[model samples]
Target chain A: MDKIKCECGHVNPEGTVLCEACGKPIEGNQHIDGNDKKTLLNMRYEGSARRSKTYTNSIVDKIWSFFSSVKVGVWLIVIALIASALGTIYPQAEYIPPEAVSRDPAVFYEATYGITGKIYYQLGLHELYGSWWYMILLALIGVSLVICSLDRYIPLRRALKIQKPKRHETFIKRQRFFSETEHVTTDEIHSVKEKLQQQRYKITEENGHILAEKGRFSRWGPYVNHIGLIIILIAALLRQTPLLFLDEYVWVREGEQTVIPGTDGEYYIENKKFIFETYSEEDGEIYKEALEKQEAMVPKNYQTNAVIYKKKGETVAGADPELEVVKEAEIRMNEPAKIGNGFTLYQAGYQLNEFHTMSFKVHRTDDQNEKALGTFTVDMNNPKHEYELDNGLTVKIDQYYPEYELDDGEPRSISKFPRNPAFVFLIYPPNETKPEVSFVGIGKNIDPTNENEYKLGIVDFDMRHVSGLTVRKDYTLPIFILGALIFMIGVIQGMYWQHRRIWIHPKGNGVLLAAHTNKNWHALKQNIEKAIANTSIKIVEDQQELDKDVSKRGGES
Target chain B: MSLEQRKANKAHKMKKRFIFRSIILILMLAAIVYALVANFNKDKSIYRAGDQAPDFKLEQINANNELESIQLSELKGKGVMLNFWATYCKPCEAEMPFMEKLYPEYKEKGIEIVAVNLDVNTLVVDRFIDKYDLTFPILPDHKEQVMDLYKVGKLPSTFFIDENGVIVDKVDGALTLENLEKQFQKILPKK
Candidate 1:
């Protein structure tokens, strides 16, 4: 190949096998007989270089290069996979409150995932998806999609559009399939060219020789593949929608109607029937093993329904969706109801709760003082409630589980629901010099150690059973859908397109032809060769005879 | 074709190929990023079994020596037992002696217990500890950090954890001695 001035004006960087500076092919090209070869990026880069204008190599440029280079693109994928996995290994390092996450946090951090995991959490790697570095990595991939596609698209299109060459001699000779055949007559060569053309192959003939080719899309598939990828990437970028999750549990008792708490306005959640289903005994055994493994829960179903109310007077909520309680709905494991603002109401967990008031009294032990610590109601869900006794003591009804279970080994629930609700009570005494708090189980009250002023007595106790339900709404579902769609499309386009090429050279005896294909070459070459072989009108005895006839015909023409 | 012309033609064609092949890689990356950003602002719902418990910043009479309060943020990505207790509470007092016994042996293995004291009587609180032979760190919660945040209306509410510190469950009232020991084993591997 002779040195050609690449549009880059850099002499195509001399034997540049490929244009590193401008990204255009610089040698071994058989398509360009004229000057129309430079791509958009090449022309621009060349123009800037020629003007000697100060071009600040911007971040976009680095990103452009990074994305275009297969090496860089591969690196980004590696980084993302590793980072995403790391994120799974650690926590986000953020939370709701101190008491909410009460635990020995320091030792916990040091033990798992190790020092590195902790560092990753601090660096926000635990929450790597939205971090600046992660986005940049993704953006680099996006740019790569553009640059890589641009690099290949223009050239592939130009190559596809290339007209038949003046002669296919050198090109055919360079192919792995070229063969010298001499037994053909001049008439036979003409017939071969005619046959190729009849078979829908594009051909160019010179003197007594012929060149034929077919199925050029295969050659351009990768370039097309690149464009598809870019479109996919752009689609992905468009898909970047940061989500806001509302993960609070709200009470929706079997009979009451309530609104789901989230930024996307209130939703009418009516309890048509809060029902629970259990696994069959046999299936439970099979799934019990699965449950022990913590595999997905063997779910039966947790169903509910309620009147959807736009307002207190808005046609009565769940009883009619449009104007009142409408329909009965059932929710189960792996099944959730889509509510509002990309929210899904899932049946995460349940509790056997209760609602009851406990009666107690406090009398002064000291003859000098008289005070009465009275009774109160401790709502299980709302534990902060308390009663102030006349004697200046505050009693908060802390935790109360109607069906309580001990944390020992067996996981057994209290046999009866509301018949016996367990209570955790915390008592506070008012003292200017020093305040004191005491914890007591509902039936196990201990009097003040002062052993002088006051003693609390339990007069009466009551319990009722209720169901505890957990609510959840996460917003990443749509992105998952979109990603699935893109992957399928890309794979189909990449896997199905086949590339086929043929080169035919005219020589003295007849036409010398060769065929090659990038993919599906096995079947394609066989068919094209068969077609060409059949097209030869007649065969001369030998090379000597074929040459004699071809030269004589040349003279006559 | 002249060598120069041939080179130009090849350059033109190669550019197209480069562009095409790389697009797939780019799209894959974009898809991953999009998925991530989509989930970013949503609640992580991170507190789970095998997840680290979240750390908190706390003020204790002793942390003053370090001139800094406790930091709860660091505790996540590990397992721990964060119990909120008050001085006068019987259950809280009953649980301390047990926690004190298990803490030393399990602390190195990964188990941690933060006894947040919401004692009405700080003076009486000291005597209660001395009365039961307690050894674990008792963090005073005068600010009610644990109370207001955890919505703790009950005393001796202990949060259990697995290897990763995410709170697995919250226990109210005094755990039976056998139960506390079993839980300590569950949260921490044998040292």
Candidate 2:
């Protein structure tokens, strides 16, 4: 029994191809066994342990090897995919349910979906994306990717970086493509070098031997892609942190100002105007209409002329604070406007304001006779002001209800449209502390018991639109975008590029050339043939010759 | 080293690697199981029953028709009925009279009703208040801050907060006089 001492002073077994401590090839220690030859050709870091142990004495070592396993990585990915697909079976919690349902999710689910809903609730699939298990799955995958890449990358990089121009006979012989020529001249070697250089191969020559390599960066492609994926996963997790991502919907009526939610009143947006249009055919009929009425008019475009403002003064108690206009922009569907450094405003939807204008008649009525005192027009757009009548009476427009209705004996506005317009008016006689209240509809009125004092009637009314804008602010957007770009680059590099290497050694006035590639053996063979096209170098593609040569060498040794 | 010794060393290394890998796999699986169990018992909502309500400030119309700001934190020791409603919502209109009817009786018991109006139109809110003769604090959530905070997907949502600022119950629809009384009883401070 004998132990071989490496140049680095580390003693390894005699049969070892490399120094176990430093991952360096142990020269002149040739066992030239079948397994040794396979290790030379395929194993990048020959000195390092190739397979994980079945049992470990220490707990930490056991854990380390678990994460380092490619099998674990694949299993994690498969499980995560299955869980994600299962999540899609029922809509995520964030998406709005299709119908008007109960606020109690359990009750709503049970009522709507029955047994499936029960299962969905019991399994906690309603908020699957944000669920702890899903988070753990992502975390495990991230750990797996990190461990798997680290385990292989360091050794591969070391092996690739310290590659030699001349290789062992066993190593050269084991190559998929090999060639030996007799009576080779220096001129032929020069021509081959020139052809390889022309083909963009980086060449290194030492001691009458040449090593040409290309697409070395492709070797790092998988690791780079893994890094990008890890970054994307981290960014996704970061998005869950408060203030990193904020998605809020704000409904702004035209000419109305409101503070943006989640901005802490730091920003305010006012809707100057909302414009809505529909597509019409040459026949002057709205496209996608049902019968004579417009059932579902194909929306042409919608835009909201919004003015963004920054809070100027400290909001004093009981006082309206001043806001300075930062930017004025028209936000349309698909076109988002950036507000400050964080927020982006997008036009999401619109609601039509049906009550445009209300024409009212002030009537003075007695028990015997009723006469119209005066006619007045109240603009629905600005329905906050009071109008003074000529009969020493003040008519203050309190509320304008479009599509007014009485539900369960309670007065309410059904919709934004002016299908049934109503108005609540407060009539002050002269200097009364409390004004008389009256509810007036288009053709009816909730008349006061004392109709002799004053009566109001709504003559006519008209309609207009308001836009719904979605304000979004995500700090992790840049990180997510960068990760996506890097991932694409990594994928392209890994899948499209092939790492190829060739070794050329002068064997007693003749040359022996050997070539190997991580992928695309046919392409590497073609490249080699093209490199030595002008020379008299004939390639030995037959495996039998290589085997015979290796056996003879072994016999001689 | 002898061939037998070298083989033994290799076997030992393989054993170590296997144990290491197995440990990591087991730990990850354990973590997944823990997360699943924890998730099953967790309440996802920010404002759920038995949880302390997040405080907010809103502009409320006072007795003089002037806009005055009111903060929920100021009424910490008093029972608070935090209601999220829009003027357009029918159930909200239906429930206002009942709320107004109970306000006087509850006010004597140190109970405060903070009705948050989600409508952008101030005039509509003012008129609705005047029409209903509601004496309770009518807070106008012009930006719908309180609405968004409570995650009010539907209108007329009411949260009954006890004197300790803890949410006792959350009712989603319009409440009648009887329902309001029952909810108020739960939130009313123990005397």
Candidate 3:
């Protein structure tokens, strides 16, 4: 094989290790660890562990090194940064369709990163706070943080526990500050020690050599704080689970009791009052807009007949309402009545409702048809008695709308609580195929709307208010809270007081002092320099007079 | 070694540690920006409020008397009103006659109205159309592709496309002829 001259341009031989002419290393066989004759495509795969081969270190050892290595920590920080950037691409806790949530290859990339809005939807990227993936990422980060912290924690504890006074002479001499003096005795140093003690420094004297370690043991606090953060993150994630569901919305609606999807009892909320209290942001004004601005008073709570029924085994359907399970009672919105191990209700919101004049059919339109299509105004709160109707139709109030409005040609109500009452009727008979629904406005002409010859009119109208209540059952809250509290404590302890070590040695006539800290070294240095000002030393002088000196140096130029 | 010198050197190193903590805090804030929205791709679906619509053919309910199929491409010189409505939706009933007045006035400006009915029975639709005295295209969307393709979740939707079949704007609820004329002005070129 022919060999060309390399710049520093010196050539020796084909398999030469070094260039004999210029005494420079040859660019020949030494760097040719593999064949140069073979192309990259034809190169045989080593199939060896590349990381291990490159590192020549155990992965565990590497992980340990990485945990302590600022470089690896920086890389982890970079990963966190990149991950955060990815987070900005979409929100977390987005509306994820269940089918796309699985790790299907065709959808995984799209679902995970949300290339085609899937990232926005299925991945819950929009609602990042409560998303499964974000929580998982947080969990992974927490685990790594825990593992990394634990890995450093043990060694740091052990290392910080004991002090080796026998440091290298060169290291002690190489310290940034030192002083040379002869006449001072060890007795004169007692005053300095007293002063340091006054500053709340912990002084530990080991062997004949005096080793005073202050703020020494506190260095391990940051590690403890890390463990706390992991716990806190876990607690945060736990709070978002289905077991700890937090459904926050205004009122569910009055008289229309929901079964409390995640809880035990079916809370029957009654809208007793929907009072909107407002205050003025500007100088105590008493206007409606000002009041709304000052205090965003929403429907506070639900006051209703809360009947708790046992899990089916306790009573028959026909059994008396008194025999039903009396688990607990609650008014909702901060007024909870506890009866057993199970519930708690909070008033998240209320529906602003009004009374309605129901129009239901009392009699059948046809004699053959058994259907009694009628317009009756029966109170929604009490459907049992006191029915009223305008004409032949016996009306029963079914659903009431308070704040009613008309959209398109149909009547629609904004408020379900009957703030402005309207009736939805079941008209039976003569025209049973399609029941007539006419919104007879309060005191409006209904004669024109009775186009159907078999007129069904409102007989009775009752307006009773109702409220919607929310009930909750979450057993894991206390545990999750406990985790958070513990985490906070750990974090405070670990993050504040860092472990700082200083080595002091007598070098001939000069004393050599070298220091190292687990965290906040710059502050530690500044503090050391400040403390050094008290001591009569030139080399270890404080930073107080440097600004003037720098000004002087600049002024000369 | 001098007794005074050893104490002073240890003090200086402690000051440097505090500076390291501040840098870490700044990076933490910068990393947090990734969780917010950053992408800026404009949505250009023809069903959306602002996009060029494609030509389509639909049967016109010329009045209660006759039915004639109208192609949007054939009426390329004039603006087109595409209304997606259903019989069950009450809002569609209120919007019908207003469109009739609009068809005659704007038909001179090359404006044509195509009402896509999402219903089953022709007799029911025909009766409603006859009752309302509407003079516009009343085509059936029985195949359901247009509704599915347009992703119309709500009924009584209307899309105003230009003479070139480019969709200029759309509305979810019912519209009166006066408001529709204003919408036409927004999409149409100024003379």
Best by TM-score: 2
Worst 10 contiguous positions by lDDT, candidate 1 chain A = A46-55
**Model 2, range A1-557, lDDT digits (tens) per residue?**
34566565666554455555433556654343234454333334343332232223466555666877878989998999998998887666555342333445565556667899879877888778877777887788877777777666755565566556766565666566777888788998899899999999999987888899999888778788877887786676666654577788887777778777666667888888898977666545544254336666767789999899988876632235578989999888899889885889989988886566777877765523546576678765446568887777788876677677877986667754455767878888767757787888876688565653677776666565667888888899889888888888888887789888888878898988888776787888888888888788876473534443345222100
Among the candidates, what TM-score does chain A have in each? 0.55, 0.67, 0.57
* lDDT values for all models: 0.50, 0.72, 0.47
Interface RMSD of each: 13.8, 5.5, 18.1
Rank order by lDDT, top first?
A: 2, 1, 3
lDDT of 3 by residue, A1-557 (tens): 33335344443223333232222333344333232332111001111111111221333434434444334555665666666676676433322232232222234446466565564455444555434444345444544565455444443343334324544453343333333434334543454455445556566553323344566545555555565565555445444443453432224333333333333222222333433333334434545564565555443234544544434343211111123455434455567544344555555454343454454454433545535443444443334322444544333333333445676765554322345544444343332455444444455424345554443444556444444445555655676667667666665664676655454455555455555454576765654555445454333432223323223111000
Q: What is the lDDT of residue A354 in candidate 3?
A: 48
Task: Supply the global lDDT for candidate 3.
Answer: 0.47
Give the C-alpha miss distance for residue A471 in model 3, angstroms: 3.4
Model 2 clashing-pair count: 14
